[model samples]
Target: MVTSLLTFLSLTAFPPAGDHYSSTDSGRVRLASELAWESGRLSGNQYALLTNSSSQRLFNLADSLIKTERAAVFFSPEHGFGTNLPDGVHSTDEQYKGRPVVSLYGNKKKPLTSDFGVADTLLIDIQEVGLRWYTYLSTIRYCLESAAMAGIPVIILDRPNPLGGLISEGPIPDSTLMSFVGALPVPVRYGLTVGELFTMAQHQNWFPLMKDLKLTVIRMDGWKRSMLWPSTGLDWIPPSPNLPTFQSLYWYSGTCLFEGTNLSEGRGTDLPFRWTGAPWLNPADSILFNQSGIRVQYDEKTPVSIPGRAHKPKYENERLPGFTMKSITGDRSVLQSIRQVILSLQSAGRPLTIKPYLFQLLGSRSVEETEEEMKALNDFRIESRLYHFYP
Candidate 1:
């Protein structure tokens, strides 16, 4: 299927997947922004926009219908517009696509009433990489909260969750450990897309201000419940500095837990999460973890790559033997990966102490080998499927 960034959403609907999708089954979805504009929804109504660099292609295509004058101001999440900023840094306010861009990740994490100015609606056109730990979901919540307080309507131009709406992983975090990263009570890899999440949030009234707040989600044309990231026909733009490829995004589910440990998550290298190691790890250790259903091979040669914002990646330039992660399919569950990592750490090397922060990362107990912990993992997988907004 030849999918262009500017293509209008198809009017056609597809049937459920058979053994696999045929040429007759296609979901050439239009961006919600396009539907809104073409349908004259945003023709004259002023709005406040929450978007970033990734959506520029859509913005350019729909520019005739969506002018800067229609937006009172613009908002951006982490990594700045189009990932122009480095990881972990703040985005600065600037003019983008003709409107004044406000830094939601910088001085103000939430939009204030003053930020809305004269806008009556909040248009969300951002792309989400589909992890609760990722910051875009937090930005959406803040935008919704501020819009609710100001009594503004929010129209979400829904995008694919990239992970699709099927498989979810890890346990949900209890209220105590919740922060900017794990802001929601969902599992580490919650399956719902941004639009579905808002629907659930409003139905459950997750926020006090949104009880009567107006919410409209423009669903996509052809997207189905079962398609994975690669199936979408969209290019894999790096959602963040660390996850530069679809391969990296897939590997991230399990590998990201390395952040909680003392190991280097391949930050300085071109392949961040995919290349994990520490100066303490042994090359022979990769063989021990190979039995855990993940291929972990020690690299003897250095890979060429661009660095993120970090100038000094941990273990930079040193040929410390580290393992390369190779799980890029949802066929494998995250808890399975976590279990493998824990068992590998115990058997492959001397026992190590995990930091408390891991609880926040995995949204469950630290990677301990226990029956109760295992039950939590199973319960998370079974319970989270209830939140699937698609299919």
Candidate 2:
């Protein structure tokens, strides 16, 4: 018997013993912190950590080896160490779990020697949602460059990209479009794991100071290019406040584009990125979006389905007619969702302006405004020629 592509992609259940291991089962892929402790590598090493609440277990594993949670201090990214802050709301320094956590958002987008205190190594294990502008990637680059200045090594305990490490999509970001949202230009749905990305950056000399920085990535085991979240057999940890489920995360690439426009993006609703409707659009008439795979549904295709909180979604009490998203191919097809929504808005004469922010939200990558949507992205010279790490 032969298997289908969908069958291979939808291989969700745990594999048998001694085969492909997962943290859920065989635990083949160990966290860098965990591996360090087991190999007696943490001894006599003064290392600072760059982590958040979702990935705190890595820190804890390290602490168990060192016998003290007392680091000189800890470094935190966007949502703070506790992962409790709302989007765009600046977080102040706070003592979390007995260690001072420094904010890495707003003007302080990168790390400094001061943030590291007396430590000489940095451990990064933030669960990135695999989007170019998710900011974790930027945070990693900053840490790399700062580690170079601080003369330290960065050990990345890589996490599985929710969208998997195959099938790169969307356009390569223009150099002019660089921001905290996008440190280096890659596809919006880049296919590399965080560690793989770091390796590429280091080899590409993207970070001049850290081009030769001593970097190590503790990679996952049993993961493949085409596998999505379910195939990993790992649980979901919300990378940000807005994205609460695999469904929400899958729909994020598409719905996130709405942030650039005036549309509500289902902010206040329970399905932040999953369902979108604006006051001007009517639900019954289907004012826009007639793409083959585009859809509006309560349950979306994913390894799992989870309902998240939307305290004050856009058009709260008023009726806003919009569409829900689906993952005809893993939710990574966010560009499709985005392209359709833009067409819908254009058809409705909603004045979808291409402000600088619109491009920024799209990670500065070029998207066609006309009906001919992008099926394949324009490959970058750096990506195709020099920086690629995958086979």
Candidate 3:
């Protein structure tokens, strides 16, 4: 059945529209939130905003709505309104500029009809890191479900996928593995902007409420599928507290898998997701690199308790020998390198244990099997392209 779907997609998929950078000017990319506010799209409606600190760097959508009396209640995703809270930390309801700020993380992942208060619309403007495991995608899905249930429309202020929209990696997750981290069946690097992703979901019937949900995506002006964060001419705002730099986000696709393992995935350190190490990790086992354009260096680092970032991270206060990875060409898959690292550690007589959380992160039990499934996702990729707003 899957083979037939792939073959059909291969025959009917839309042809490439050529490279966006070749024809269009790659100046400062204008955000959809700024465009919506400048125009009358964000006016007159008492809307609730699902946003974080990342959305405020260019234009403060929350502030603009509040000042105009269009904001009814404020909603925050995984990291709270400020985006300063640590991972897994529960965000409480609070007051933001005299407005009720409700957290979409923690106990309540979705909003109730009453949570909307006197709002008629829901405005979402959070910046996404272009990975499935990032909780923002799940939050967006929940918001859509809630909006559909409440009969309110959702206006998504689109942002650029920091990793660009070209290369997708890893497997389309199994349905049984659906969680907050792996909400939908998209690959690890799904390669779609948040708006594009939700649009694909709604069109493809990924969720039941998607068909009933009224969604309006305010598209960006100059973003291209080929342009990464650096190419977009926008400042790097840490979507989360740990991903402070573009370099950290670059290697996050693979290194984020370290979070499920026994090793410290660079949490509580200066560079999270870019560094992975443990006390048991042998220095000799670190010589593992199968993927080209990836450089690894051996280093020693200790995880410490940084308030609001990584409070009591794994292996905290313990100096461990580990390697830091740097991408030379920025196109190679770090997933292969990390997989090889796991194999090498096991080969060197290290008692490495794979946890159940690893399956949740990878969306499958075996990395090799997931890679095989990823190869057969031509149909899914082509179907995704049908909803692409940009070239």
Candidate 4:
């Protein structure tokens, strides 16, 4: 059995220095769900799980809860219960393992009071990719709101931010620009784990109504701020269909910007988010990266219909010239890379038509404006540190 939170807290009060850590150390990290299960924290309560296939792959929390008769109902985020629905598609209510599964991404983005049924507690265990546009963060926020209004305690099983917690990039979203995609005021690449983000949310009054909500974060064991997904020794499961690999996720923070343009962000292709282009672009024109250990090479790709993943994706069935990016070392600055791509496309006489949706994605009017605002992140960085569970 795993140690109690009290014992774990005292042991991890002072994290080890970053230089002494090994990236290849398997089994060094223990998930909060695993610890919670071993310690029997989930035995007595009927839990309404806000989770997806990624969490199922990681620990099978739902199956365990059902096996022990502690599952009340299951909740799914943007993609659906099994994550088999395409982007922007609404998932209808379904049955999973003889229990009702409600879709939070359907007609209603938040759970109704009646949806709770017999559940006394709300448990969130979905994996997040550490980007503002990832809808899982918004789903969690909505669930928190529902839990607060319903007068129930919430348990969050903390997971590592695939991009790591060492760096944050881009600018905070304007209050007027807040939507399901840009729910929080944090930067595009906010460096906090899901647990830390919600903790900071309650403390900082991001959602003033949730201030009194009973929230408990079952913290991960041996996870450090410097450790990325690979460093944590956790298997990589695609949180969403598009982000299939770490390389795809690494480039997503920057390349996702293409979604607002006429260019294809590699959707319907095997390399979604890793490859970006349009038929109008010239392959001979090179895109440069200022960050070290980064390489961008010219290539050609064709997007096609992939039922559950992407259907009728942008410029589907057309071959287009694009560039693929790969990182040889650690995480590189994604904002800088975005700027570089913008300049390169402009220089190639293919000036991008700025879509209104781009502002929502960047959380700013333009890349240049966002870059200017990024100069003032020192305060946010410091303020965020107060809620850090790991060093």
* Reference-based TM-score of each model: 0.84, 0.80, 0.91, 0.90
**Worst lDDT window (10 residues) for model 3?**
14-23
Tens digit of lDDT per residue, candidate 3, span 142-189?
A: 988998999999888788999999887777787899999999888888
Error of 1 at 21 (Å): 21
Maximum-TM-score candidate: 3
Q: How close to the true structure is residue 26 of candidate 3, measured as C-alpha lDDT?
A: 48
1-391: candidate 1 lDDT, tens digit per residue = 2243113112111111221112332555455566555556565678788877666564442255254467677888998865766667887888765667788898989988998888888988888877888888888998998998898988787777888777766666777878788888777776777887776666555677777777777666556668777877767777777777888887777777777777777776767778777667787777655666677667743423344445465555777667887652445675567556766786655545577777787776656545665576576565444434346
Instruction: lDDT winner between 2 and 3, please give it.
Output: 3
Stretches of model 2 off by over 4 angstroms after superposition: 1-32, 57-59, 62-66, 284-287, 297-319, 327-332, 351-354, 369-391
Better of 1 and 3 by lDDT: 3
lDDT of each: 0.69, 0.63, 0.80, 0.80
Give me the displacement of residue 389 in model 2, in angstroms. 7.6
lDDT of 4 by residue, 134-194 (tens): 8989999999999999998898888888898989888788799898889998988899989
Pitting candidate 1 against candidate 4, the one with the higher TM-score is: 4
- The true-versus-predicted C-alpha distance at residue 316 of model 3, in Å, is 1.1
Q: Rank the candidates by lDDT, best first.
A: 4, 3, 1, 2
